[model samples]
Target: MVKNPLKIFMLINCLGMYDWSLSAKYFLNIYVFASTIQNSGSQRHMHFIKKTLNMEIFGCFALTEVSHGSNTKAIRTTAQYDPTTQEFIINSPDFEASKFWIGNMGKNATHAVVYAQLYTQGGQCHGLHSFVVQIRDPKTLLPMPGVMVGDIGRKLGQNGLDNGFTMFHNVRIPRENLLNRTGDVTPEGVYSTSFKDVRQRFGASLGTLSTGRVSIIGMSVVNLKLALSIAIRFSATRRQFGPNDDEEIPVLEYQMQQWRLIPYLAATYVLDHFSKTLFMDLVELQLGLLQNDKSIRQAELGREIHVLASAGKPLASWTAQQGAQECREACGGHGYLAMNRLGDIRNDNDPNCTYEGDNNVLLQQTSNYLLNCITDRHQDKVRIESPLESVNFLEDFKDILGQKFMISRVEDCMDSSVSLAAYKWLVCYLLRESFQKLNQERKSGSDDFEARNNCQLYKNLWATVLQGSKVLERPSWWREFSSYKPTVGSLKSKL
Candidate 1:
């Protein structure tokens, strides 16, 4: 599985071109479900692996509840420990507690990895815990008793995949059904874990969360590429007004068209590389965790991976959103035609911004990680030693900020090195400014949450936007100029 990350991503990308709904369905069922089972430890879930791999059992992940989407802690579904029966009674107390928008749960999936608040026999709620719950009878193709499941109606797009909702009413399952790799209950109804800190355990339990975001990054790139390919090709072929009475020029010749499309074209290559690099990093982290290699470096690498996934997913998805819109507009009215496929691309890619994690909320995670890094630097707690060296520039933040953009001409501003340097400075400036705003908010009597909320305009938006732009812009500049060769009679080129 570690060796297959790139292959898996490429397959998803290819599948996305044919039909996004198909790719999304397979991605959720195979990638997300398999990742969860793998992370839950094979000792207990090997049977599940065998059944799923053999195609005898289909599964979905049930995490987001009707009342709780992003806030996993607030989900009200309960798995109460029944000590006498040695089972857990999974129940949804109210309508809001039902699991919503679960892929494949509407009609097909036989089981689900359900996340619910676990309560011990003593009435102690043990944060969020995952359990393998049977939602349907595989043989009869009917909903299991006490499991209310059905498809949620139409969506904006990707309608080929069934989005579903589920509610459990006094459903009983064996205690061993719990995904107990992170936390577990004793036969005597005691809750215990190797990790004492709840936050640490939460982090550990998030092993499967990053996989969806990583796949989304790759899928977004695929959508962007598809959009650009159509727009650029059509621009090159379609003709418009020109100087001569009988002559018409291809839209690609227009400066405005090139300016509009080329940057996204450049971004495609840049994000493609970034996504691949991130996929490899994730593969390494997954292997390390699977092997139980609990070194400090591994822990730091995990944090870095999480931060990158959070930031990169939003970056890639938003880029696709804007790029698809541009592609649609650049194609004139024809782009809106169903035959052109741009509208489908736009709608299919839109949900990515909100699904895995809302883009805005995800950006906050990145900003918080950045702020923590800055704090650690100032307090001399830890050196800025990112495994990917993404944050190493923070070490020279002062130097970077002091330097100003010195390009003399518009052409100079187009220079890849100049653009990259400017981007670095932009990120550094935002980081410093955001830190200041957050500190000021705290000083003005706001609590941590309120201060963080208040600083979102400066911290979250700037940090995520600038950092993501820098990531794409740097490689984009390199790929754009590095591969170009000038003809002898052409205008002077930077390369």
Candidate 2:
């Protein structure tokens, strides 16, 4: 195993991992079913219906591989067809190509919805895709033939998961295993999928990625809240440097400490509002997608929400990580102890920057989506509408950046309004820079791969811009704050 067992146990304890396990099972069996019955049914049900449906549990989502952590196109595992038995012959081909870093994968999971390259006619397959594979006995929890599984071992945090790696030496699963909602395969060795463009098909796999990003953003907000509350309360009580030239004063009084804590406090408020707004918007998008087959609005919303989530998570997580560090430093020595919770908070939030898409790689997705809109308007004469309007700053980019947004009536530095102005300008600045870099790449004859990699740098730049804009423009979260809305009774009275 790659992870240290002891540290894993401790981290798991800190995170209430057992509680998550119970909650997951409960939701999978009950709430998730109740919610999805009218829809497509629990994804778990869709993946595993005939194979010991009640007793078995699955731990799979084709995300990370030993060699290709974020780049799905590089994954080397293959699920090729076996004509005689009508099964897919699964093979790792090599160690670096082996499946790794999957949660609940060690010995806890009996089944996995494996991701592999689909091959039919011996021609090279184009992209990564998902398939159902039974790896162990649901009752026994042991590896099956031509299969190997074990833990990845110690990390900074997140230990409850039996994150493990597996190698398939010609392991086999049925040919009917392909999850065909987006793509499919025929028994006579044929490939079929709705997506004509390979890139679009690749993108189809990431539809749920936005949901994960949104949840992580929400998690980052709560984590910030927890750390802030602890530090703020402690600072109010803990006394340090001085008052009337004699007695010690509460640490909260120190301007330096307040400076460190207050921005985080303000940030937590901003992120809280941002998360709530994104969630509501996501709900509407989800509902529309479920109700209608082709939802242009929802697709746009998904792209927008994903961009927001990707943008907010890195900002909020990096902020929370820094805030936790500050909180620890502010508390002096006691904060180092696990009991105080700041260190644990830091450890937990650290992964947020790397997982569910590494912050850098994920940022490119945001930039790509934004750039696509910008380029479309310029090249196709396509008049962009909807959420792209949020990016209107792109049109007046030079003017927006050349002058301060709210010059004359600049509010107090601490006021939320001042922060909003800074944030808006940052967004405009980054958007302009991204467009400029994109245009330059096109002009300079850079290859598609190099251009895309170059865009990653702009993504990080935009993140900083997005963070500054959040402080200066509108708080996404504020829309959801109950305090901002009219009372339900007042609305009812109008009715």
Candidate 3:
């Protein structure tokens, strides 16, 4: 177990700089499963780690079903406990229930940590549970009996990764194969859990799932940096229209080029710091969990971390998506050339916005968490207790809501502080409006899901904007801006 999880993120960032597709495959297949098993406390499967570290066995995570991506609860795959045989049977009832878009599962993986609905002897379905199931033989590279697996074919990017699919038909494994940290099934087929609340237990079980999303944040920064580096360097070198016929100006000197590329450059610095800080926070939470600290504070911290990841993934990914496209366009015909690598960067990053969790669906989680905080404060159940203080400003909701944008000049708006204040106001306003819409929907006899869906537009926008502003605040780039003036002058000198 790495004491600092951020180190993993940094390593992924470096790998992404070389090849994002390779980094994505490593993240989805190795890093995520490793983190899950470490947190899962499945001692019986610990050898999988040794094999992985020794380069003996490759692994993939299988969660997304053919018909169910974000909706884990709706997955139809079943793992039924058989007390008579002292084993668990894993099965996919239909094609729709087959696992889809599983990285590294098609061609290379020898094992998988599969998520399936658990069933005891009493015919009770106990939500989703993780199971370590052997998918292929290490030496022969063949699928096990009763398992159907194959590659998903080529993709827009990440074609190097064998994104695959799997289906199981009455595949039986030992009862000990279950990842039973939060809940377990005994030989007698009794299902037991430490937490009384199902939701809380689910939360505890998924404490480490954010690792992939956190890494995506850093990978997005890498993508942004790559795109900006190529575009900016090209802009500095490529010459165009000039004031005199005898000389041509560097593209970087054009205000349009600066406007297109500089802000994203600044954002790259901002998101880089934000991603590292978030990774550190994740490390702290994981360390506490590893120490078996089940305190309420730890649980709250986990929840906070989840919300941050849910929002941060989308924020960083969408930024990379837009930045890559912008950079591609800024470099003109040269960026379109395969030699420059901008196209691959753009295509590779597109999936980040949709994977782990769909960006829009993930935003709903953050918004729902925010709504709960506001409700808790209003009902006096608790103060705005954000362990990370990401939402502590909600405590001063009234004041924040009252604030109006006052910056009248472009110069004033350029200051980070002014931008922060304005964004805070916007977040507060959107939060209030979203809350009102949700309440109105509920008052009309809509269920929680309906109410949330009704407010999706505001909730999504609020989370996205709030996360961007938060990241913008994490880096001390103003001083760096002052120091980099000479570099800008040098680019101009090329004219």
Scored by lDDT, the top model is: 1
Deviating ranges (above 4 Å) for candidate 3: 1-4, 404-415, 469-495
| Model 3 / residue 360 / CA error / Å | 1.1
**lDDT (Cα, tens digit) per residue for candidate 2, span 246-269:** 899998998767866887888889
Model 2 bad stretches (over 4 Å): 1-55, 122-126, 245-247, 287-292, 387-389, 392-406, 409-422, 451-459, 469-495
Model 3, 233-292: lDDT tens digits are 999999998999999999999877887788788888988998889888888888787787
Clashing pairs in model 1, backbone N/Cα/C closer than 3 A: none
- Predicted candidate 1 versus true structure: per-residue lDDT over 153-269, tens digit per residue: 899999988999999999999998888877899878999887777887788777678888888999899999999999999999999999998999999999779878998898889
The lowest-lDDT stretch of 10 consecutive residues in candidate 3 is 486-495
Whole-model lDDT for model 3 versus the true structure? 0.83
Where does candidate 1 stray beyond 4 Å? 1-3, 406-415, 467-495
